[model samples]
Target: MIKIRNPEQILSHGDAASRKLVLEIADLTLARLDSYRRIKSIGRMEGSLLHIGTRSWDLLKKRNVYLFGAGKACNHMAMAVDEILGDYLTEGLAIVKVAEETDAFRKTKVFVGGHPLPNEEGYRASKMMIDLVQKSGPEDLFIVVISGGSSALMSCPIEGISLQDEIDATDVLLKSGAGIYEINAVRRHISAMNGGMLAKRIQDVGAELIGFGISDAVGSPATGNIGTPYAAYKSTPIGPDPTTLDDARATIINRDLGERLPRSIVDYLMNAGPEGETPKSFPHNTYFLLNTLPDSCIYAKQICDEIGIPALIVSSFLEGESRDAGTFFASMAREIQTYGNPIKPPCVLLSSGEVTTLISDNSVIRGHGGPGQEMAASFAIAAAKAPGACLLSVDTEGTDGTTKVAGGITDSSSFQSASNKGISLFRALREHSCFEALDAIGDVVFTGNTGTNLCDLNIVYVPGIDG
Candidate 1:
């Protein structure tokens, strides 16, 4: 499901040990695919009982079965679910940023949409999804698949807020250094289908809704946005998610998005419409986590352990500025060499989280690279001090933001490679065009849609102490 482009160049161009670590990280990232993990997580339908991640529904008695959702990888997740539901699935609808997979979905209609911001395509897709949900009856069982990018792919702006208004707001947030939680809070309030509003609509009509969430929002215990359609805000989120109002307030007070964004966005946040998103409780339905980024990292760690290498999980829920976070990760490698603390060298540092790139510079196309590339370029420059160090950063979903490439991998000598070519790494970083710079130096990682959206995967290899 995951393919690394220019593998020979990427693996052999850097420190061999870091290449192996990259191989391991890439291998494990593919290992956690929905096709593979779903078997272990979702039980098959046996006559009447259909088990899905600790929850079972009596499908034999149910009449209408509808499926609907939106996300980056919901297409693959929906396909996996379709295989299990088989003949029972009546009709389905889903909106996805990428059409990664198309199997096990003969009955489901997939709509291609946009991400990081909503577009007219997503606007139309969301209306179709709403219609599918609204038509569901008491006898119907709706299986909802929610993953990252759902907030945009499945958006239908509330009254007085146009689709363009929502799109402008999202663009501002993406560049405002706002995390997924903050972004989603504003999203849930502005969207006609978020913050459990969809669930409330279903519950009012007495239909059943069950969800499977493929988390991409810092899955250190899977915090922040629960992909929204899992009846978000049913209980206070385990992740540090602000309420719809609080998030708007925080964005204005903390990030100053009020002045940076369009006036329509500011006015909406300031004065909520009467048809505000105050979703009633959805107490019965449960959201199941099929797998997470931590699970992927741990699986990779197990492989390293079996191969007689010491490894450490730095943090599964890392967040902050992409460039800064990359430097801090390189620092961990430096510490292993200097102090011999935190599991020493000849070790692998594993972490998974979503970092933000606040693209304030307008000299270049802000969509040139994702957070992973920003972090990877920064790490390459910082780890120049530790020749024994190397790292790889990738968005598990494959494409990061607007780029076709997943992310990048770089060793300590990567900076030298760029310098030798007269490519100023910092200049590319400043322009938010790391993709162009990394591509020139052969450090870009290309995994064309792994058919999953967990989060970002970061692995730093320090190969001085032991093997």
Candidate 2:
């Protein structure tokens, strides 16, 4: 168990309390990440295969193992595998946003790349992974490690789509307020490796493919872990083609990706699954280590309760548009304050999951933000209308969206600060610019790269409504 400073102390106006709250949230988030890390460690090859199903053990014993790890958490997961598998790791490749020359990772090939957006480096690393898969024969074993950021970090745009096209499309979709499923759906359609396409590519290599996934999405590990083409399709849109780059930008600028995804991506997505009957080839053996949001929510609830606040565990799998989700949570807080129904006053409402933002053409050239910040800012806007309510949203991974900070917190003062500065919180949110809003009020929550990625954590504290 990790100890966090009392929420009350942190919420206090004193600098010590404020700093303590930030530190405590950071600590709690890190602890959650660490717990997941431990699970990955224990699930390694040498760590008691006895508990695993017989089929998994049989697959493990096979030789000629080739490994690939992708996503934000991939570096740590790969390092843990190295610790456990040691010399048995015949050959492996890891793609992460932050790969360092640490002692634990010295033995493996680690490629540092971009996240939330695919860069040239990310594309290069992804191509290397594809090459590795293509080289493997029937006798080889392929181990693919996947986590949250894999969709962006392992990006390989398909034919007819330039890397810039994909990047531009991604930027639009993000600000367009699309959910993760929708954003990823568009991503899968445009990519060579997403939407279980990677799994399909190596299906016939005769190698026993073992996928170890740290699910950042909701359930459906294959979909959540490796990027399901179907889910991505579900999230994207079937539409009229955009004639020019300007048109494409306009489509994204005026419309929400949440409202619709690219027609090309959507069409390809619709043709997936058994009914659509594309390729049926996939890894026979796959394992998902943890779907962690539930546990994190439980932890948050316990912490809130310990602090003498009634805490409600609303849902661990919260999803949908960032602004809507924020509004929904805000409504809950409002309800408690007005009616005291679901939860009384002096209570907390906690949720975990991924929220998405959509981008349009106007800001595509100047856009910079991620989901966590969007969620925090959206919640802040919502909380602004509900007096006496304070909310905090963060990405447990310590990196929210593309920024260095995890997320932000909001109180009544957040709105006042923005108003005084001639900044409209709503306008900032429309641009998916939470950092600006939070920064203006000194509300940004900064926790540098916490080695774990479970999902987002949201806590809404409603004061003095219970009694």
Candidate 3:
């Protein structure tokens, strides 16, 4: 099945052969990243016993089994758990970035939540989840599926902090050019349902907790033998958090966001006692690590090998300014095509990481876009030097930046294509409106929740000069 919704539109023009190859690799890689299939493969129910990986839970022994999830890919993750648990599942609630018509659940209630920012609906769903945990006891079991964007998707600010204050604070931190970890340091501390707070509530109620998560942090290794219980799982809302209150304090000081963020958030983090700190350890929780940021690149490389195409996983630690990363990737394509330096022609280069765009002044933003769109737009301008080169940059979770589209794909002819339409790529990047510019030329890539969130996945194809 094709993950890219508009493949025909994307392959209509502009180095069709190269674009087709890159899209094929992307589609295959995304198919493998499906959480629904992954969870089902490792979990099965027999009679009254429920088996997940190497562990099994007897439904007869448990009073109630509840499923709670929050993230961009929570729809599929929650669905998998709901289907496997079936009649034994007491109730389920999940907060997702997008609720698709394709989503089918046996008993779970889905709540559409905001991403990149917190909203009232997410806060409501989070409160409901907290209530569900509070009502549970020692015999009850809580299963939480957490992925990236949960901090925003499962928004329940601390008592002293208003939802708007958390939202405003998140907006300020995102635009501050700080890394995701640095930003989460502040957001987690001010949140009631994030950074191990959910797990702490379950622990307080004397309930058993089973967590399934996808780690998007850079430097995380590929998930191996997911059937085995993970011992080092941390971060997210349902696991032990590695970030501390001091980390939160340091983020504000280092980013110089003391005055930029809401005063309530600043005051809460500044004055919060040690008891207010997030739980740093949850040794009793049985967790499974599904995928990491590096897994995307690793999977792409495998697809290339199966297809008999030479491929290189350039890096899984890609970060920094989005547009600049695009230019750098484009330069690499030219070097590979002209000099055959890294690998021969007709090769694929894959990378996965979180690239960010800094927007200190929101007034400069003329249109909606994300880091993936900016990178693709920047690649288009520089790719004009390298013929037959095609690049696809997407935020694997579907939406990129503030746009509905996942990201953008650009070929060597993309620059001239935009020029013919009287669109300037440079201006698009400058104004942070690459979505509009890319959409005009049918370069915008659309994938409505590809069932995984592994941050940004950049795929580039550099065909032979003669071919």
Candidate 4:
């Protein structure tokens, strides 16, 4: 069921054996981390009795059971709940980054929302959700599913701030090389829906809230006891925001984005008092953490164990400049293949986290690319030092940066391959356009809606020097 659209194209060149193995592991990981399957396993309904994890709710007592969700993985998460609730559900609305033709929903209305940048459709959906929550009463039960990208997917700016202003601010913050936490700090305080504002709206209406979320935060530990209700969950629209107004102001100042970002955002964060701070806690709501960043590595290692391949998890908190990280990974590959310091040959190096690309000048951009593409292209350039070493970098959610492709795959021969095609990989990197370079050599990965979002997953295969 887990299919890569361009597997043959990807394996046509490079270390086919190594590429095949990497693809297999990645596909299996995507299947295992599917939100629909995860939600179904813990949630179900037996007649009028609804069960989610350890808790069971009698629908006869509740007036209405409404569902709302927004994120990159919202489609699968919302679909699972809608199917489970069946006729007992009052209504459902899901704002997703992409809407697949195969996504069959009975009770949920799907909206294709914008990601990385707020769009008009998403803004309208956010307004609709706000109206829906406001009209509901105390007897209603609200079930919310949220994941990574919700900040952009669910966009409803506070009073006096236009949607374009929020979009402009997001662009500035993302390009500033600031981390997600810092970016969320500024975004949370300015949004009417984000940063627990939606949860607050539901809370004020006296409706019971139950939230399910996937944490894409770097350095997040693997989830445990997923069925148990978590009380300390924070961030996103449904949970309490851990960020504050001070954090927002600090990010703008620290990143020197005051002059670059929209004036409305900067002025609001500066002029607004304590009342502008996002809600910090929601004591009454119940939350569940499905998967974390480290879980991707854990699942990958399990695949390696089953296949009799030696795997070492380099790090789950990988960050910093994307190209630099690629070169560092290539160096590590060389060290392992030559010195045998970390581990022997015929081994795999696995890492997961958010690696960023800094694009301060918009004019420098020549073509489409993302952190994953840049990583693989940079690896291809440096990987020549270690023959036959192959690397695969992807945004686990199936889209990397601004492209439709999952990411890119490259090996030692990729540099020469590009040379043969008269494509300058170095120039491509310089212009922040690795997608065209990788695609020209049939190294681009394609998987539409991977059904999960866990930032980036990097895999490196180092064969024996003799092999």
- Rate residue 10 of model 1 by lDDT: 80
* Whole-structure CA lDDT of model 1: 0.74
Q: What are the runs in model 3 whose C-alpha is more than 4 Å off?
A: none
Could you give candidate 4's per-residue lDDT for residues 344-369 as a string of tens digits? Answer: 98898999999999999999999999
Relative to the unseen true structure, what is the C-alpha lDDT of residue 446 in candidate 3, on a scale of 0 to 100? Answer: 94
- Residues 1-467 of candidate 3: C-alpha lDDT, one tens digit per residue: 47989999999999999999999999999999989988999999999998999999898999999999999989999999999999999999999999999999988999999889888999999999989988899999999999999999999998888999988988999999999999999988988889999999999999999999999998898899999999999899988888999999999999999899999999889988998789989989999999989999999999999999999999999999999999998999899888998888889999999999999999999998999999999999999999999999999989998989999999999999999999999999989999999999999999998889999999999988886
The predicted structure with the larger lDDT, 2 or 4, is 4
Which candidate gets the maximum lDDT versus the true structure? 3
Model 4: residues with Cα > 4 Å off, grouped in runs: none
Shift in Å, residue 238, candidate 2: 26
- Candidate 4 matches the true fold with a TM-score of 0.99
Model 2: what TM-score? 0.76
**What's the lDDT of the predicted structure labeled candidate 2?**
0.61
**CA RMSD of each candidate after superposition:** 3.7, 6.9, 0.8, 0.9
